[model samples]
Target chain A: MTSDLIAGTPAATGEGPQEMRSRSELTAKEVLREVGSVLRMSEKEASELTSSPVENDEEQTMIINMGPQHPSTHGVLRLMLELQGEKVLRCKPIIGYLHTGMEKQAEELSYMQGGTNVTRMDYVSPLNNELVFSLAVEKLLGIDGDIPERATWMRMLLSELNRMSSHLLFMATNGMDMGAVSMMIYGWREREEVLRFFQKVTGLRMNHNFIRPGGLAADLPAGWRDDVLTILEGLPPRLAEYDILMTNQPIWRERLQGVGVITAEEAVALGTSGPILRSTGVAWDLRRDLPYLKYKEVEFDVIVGSYGDSFDRYAIRLNEIRESMKIVYQILDKMPSGDYRIQDKKVTPPPRARIDESMEALIHHFKIFTEGFKVPEGEVYVGIESPRGEIGCYIVSDGSPKPYRLHMRAPSFVNIQALPHMMRDGLIADAVAVISSIDPVLGEVDR
Target chain B: MSDAVVDSPAPAEQLYGCVVTYSRGEKVIHASRGNYIATLKKAIDDSFTMCTDLTAVDFLIYASTNRQLPSDISGERFEIVLNLISLERRERLRLRVQIAEGEATLPTAFDLFPGTEAMEREVFDMFGIEFEGHPDPSRILMPEDWEGHPLRKDFSVGRIPVQFKGAPS
Candidate 1:
């Protein structure tokens, strides 16, 4: 009878996630690993924290699934929570529901067309994704140092603005997650203005794919500066309004201040980055510490938090919008005049006007679109600061037009690892706030 | 450019028995499976606390036109790349460990960097490169019952037949 039943199951035939085993079924070591205890503590220390004997523990603690559907999860992030009444005993994040096999798809797409695939991974900050992938490809092509001044500054400008827009979206969702319903409207209202600027510049609000390998797809549109200035000028008072609405509110402070706490040591060990890392009082911003592009040239403060909690994460992001604004102001002051992209004929296609007039330019454009430019046989990893965290792109080329392997080191994917640690011992109600604070984009996590 | 090659001890010539090589301005450390865990432990002690990214690449011969590896290290069917960042030193190190086709397993880095739990699971799911002693040791992205590793070059990208409404045979 057992054999007959086993024969019909998906487990015997290959279908379900096996990672969601109950905490009661897990071994002591497995529980430790699941809860992210090995992050800071030794095995003995980890065992001591989790191995405390409980009377009727299994009876008291019931296993429950929190989401793969909960709106507060950001997207399809299913967490299996072991709750001892109201307190969460253990939590395991069950992901991959949004898996579209993007890395595998990237292997099929040419380097020139790879941006479209990566851009969709972290949809909120698609520009950063494209920028990192482009930077890696450029490095492999041995033209890392040759990208024009205008292009680099333009990349910086767009990236910082994307950061602002992403943080604004976070403000909306984080507010909605915390039950401040109207703050959602206010946050989205501010963010749409940024996206409006994006649409004018990139022609699409999200997944623009405007930032390309050799340089951007095109130069900044006429009066683009004015549009950017408009956004830069308009955001402060609205952000100050957010300060009034959520930042200074007593209920907001009570809900987030001491909840979802993590330490600097644990945060680093779990490989959390961006606001999560900075929230732990570590001033480890990729833009400042490891300068990429013209980040070294820009002037902006890296916002950090003293306590690694939900409130700290929220405050860091809120302040980070201001910091990004600071960077944008400098970008405007120092926007240089030069070619928007490199003049290299091998990687960059000829100008559209040139194609209309010259036969050779038309052929070059055709070849680039169809076959794509070949990158040298080398591997390069380029990491940049996306709003969520350190988004890195690793590409391995085999003297081909397509990437042999294109891997995006998604911040959400790594940051999600720290969730169990953060949620451990916290109340079930606070879990929503914790997830909101992490600000994971499931697209990137699953991709 | 060749003449300007630094005569001084090549900054990080060797890191805990792993050969350090520079690839396009980034530092890479090549470690065999034997010393991979030990090197990682030492790397932690050396202040490379954060494991920024962990991924694997399947270099099946049919798809790979060329490979650029250091002279001494032989290329393999699968390579595990771990990008570690040292916050104190403000430096990044890339550790590449090559795993042979048949013996496709490496000890888990979970004991040191618990952050690698998900990444290890992803690698196992994608490339079928098992991280031995991994806590969960189950398929992550792909369903547990899924057979072939999707990221491997040999694995065919199969598609389901999309039957249009009112237009099926």
Candidate 2:
């Protein structure tokens, strides 16, 4: 019957028999006409019908909004998903829900106050944010090499610990997203211990604001070494417990092992960094590649993954916690004894005792506080290997007390671009796994 | 400082006719507005596979007093900065394109490096420098209905006075 329609149609149109008979062929218009005849409709009416190929299917696919407030979306991230049954054909990440205009605000604040501003961007890794900002400011001031050895060591110790804590939060949230509720408790418990150490050292748990342009906000507490040692001792066994809890569990492996796979080429093209890029078998850790803050002096390994899947990303962060612990221990062993901040008089305030005894010291302190020191006119871009990836600060100074322009090359912001690339062709159920695997701190993403 | 100078084989002057390159504290390439795309393509082909950052600095206020660029390169009101890194060589290079105020659009780097798509959009959103060929050239971090570019130097730092509930009306 189909062959009769094909032959009869070509004959009606006066087409060559040899060309028409090459195969059972009909143009889309002819096919529509044939369908029109089958449905007892006129050719004009059939030709007027317009529908997408997907709509022509027996079962139509659906479009769904995942979240600006869904449980599995981590923070305020929203995903607009196009789904065919359970499969996600296309995904668009709708962000900017947490935008606070912090970059614009940084311009009004002085360089001394800049640390406090940037430290809040990636609240999870606040010290890394502060460290990058300080480094950029120092580079603009041309005092990159003048930072005290003790301050450098302290910054390394605090930053690695921050990395550990950030990863621990990821372990917890990632576990919860995958339905392992107990891991939430375990992850937060370990993170609480790290936060306690941070509180003791910098007087704030989350946003320490300790790592400043010249040096740390204050000297470390006398018992900091032992406190960190205690944290170091407690983490290993808990890490082992997590391995037993989720790493080798059958269901965990089933959900993450082959899901959200992205190749190295795609990852780099999308500008994904941190675990997402490392999981794609690239050993590009900025800590090692572009060493800053005495990172070159420390000994540690850059953890990498074989298959760029959700499981590899999870495993890389888990192993990176161990590497960070190694770096922290090395910092403790080689703790330098010197001024924590540079005593340039312009950048740092004079000693408290000297401020009371000497008028010159008192004036220096007053000037440093009321009118912050000016940065030389220039611009510098300094990128550091934060827990998420390359958290960079691009500072353009105008020889004023305040920064001319300060912009953060937020790792979470850049890494989130890889979402649609990773989530394409994956199931809707696996979308949560993919999003959590990216470990996006929306504060950083939106800032 | 003279001993540390490592000259590029294809100098900016030789490769692109109008563009000039300078190293100030770091390697910086100064490209004219018209040759921005070609200069960037050369940098990309020279193994600068990663674009670490792309942003602009509005020199409207600091143009004359604070920064003293060579007279030939100093007059532009806005300078779009591109920081590129070569992963293989562990090296960094900076490209500064002096875009005049009237014609603030430059060719998009999306074709050379897909990563710059978001960064370019950000520059457009904040500094109002349009990328001629950007695929989705829309406000990224800001709301769609935002009024003016916030990062421009002239953008007012709007301050809203706080009002207490029942104290004074």
Judged by lDDT, which candidate is best? 1
Model 2 Cα lDDT, one tens digit per residue, A286-315: 889988878888889999998999999999
| DockQ value for model 1 | 0.43
TM-score of every model versus the real structure? 0.93, 0.86
Please provide, for model 1 over A1-447, each residue's C-alpha lDDT reduced to its tens digit, 9 standing for 90 to 100: 233333434433233345567656767766666666566566677667656333346778888998898889999999999888899878888888899899999999998899999999999999999999999999999998999999999999999999999999999999999999998999899999989989988999999999998899988999998998899889999988999998999999999999999999898888899999999999999999999988888788999999999999999999999999999999999999999899888888998899989998899899999999998888889899999999999999888899989999999999988888899889999999999999999999999
lDDT of 2 by residue, B2-89 (tens): 6447543443353334444443366676777778888877777887877778889888887564564544566588888888887778
TM-score of predicted model 1?
Answer: 0.93
* Residue A19 in candidate 2, Cα distance off native in Å: 47
How far does residue A331 in candidate 1 sit from its true spot (Å)? Answer: 0.6
Off by over 4 Å in 1: A1-19, A45-56, B1-12, B62-65, B159-169
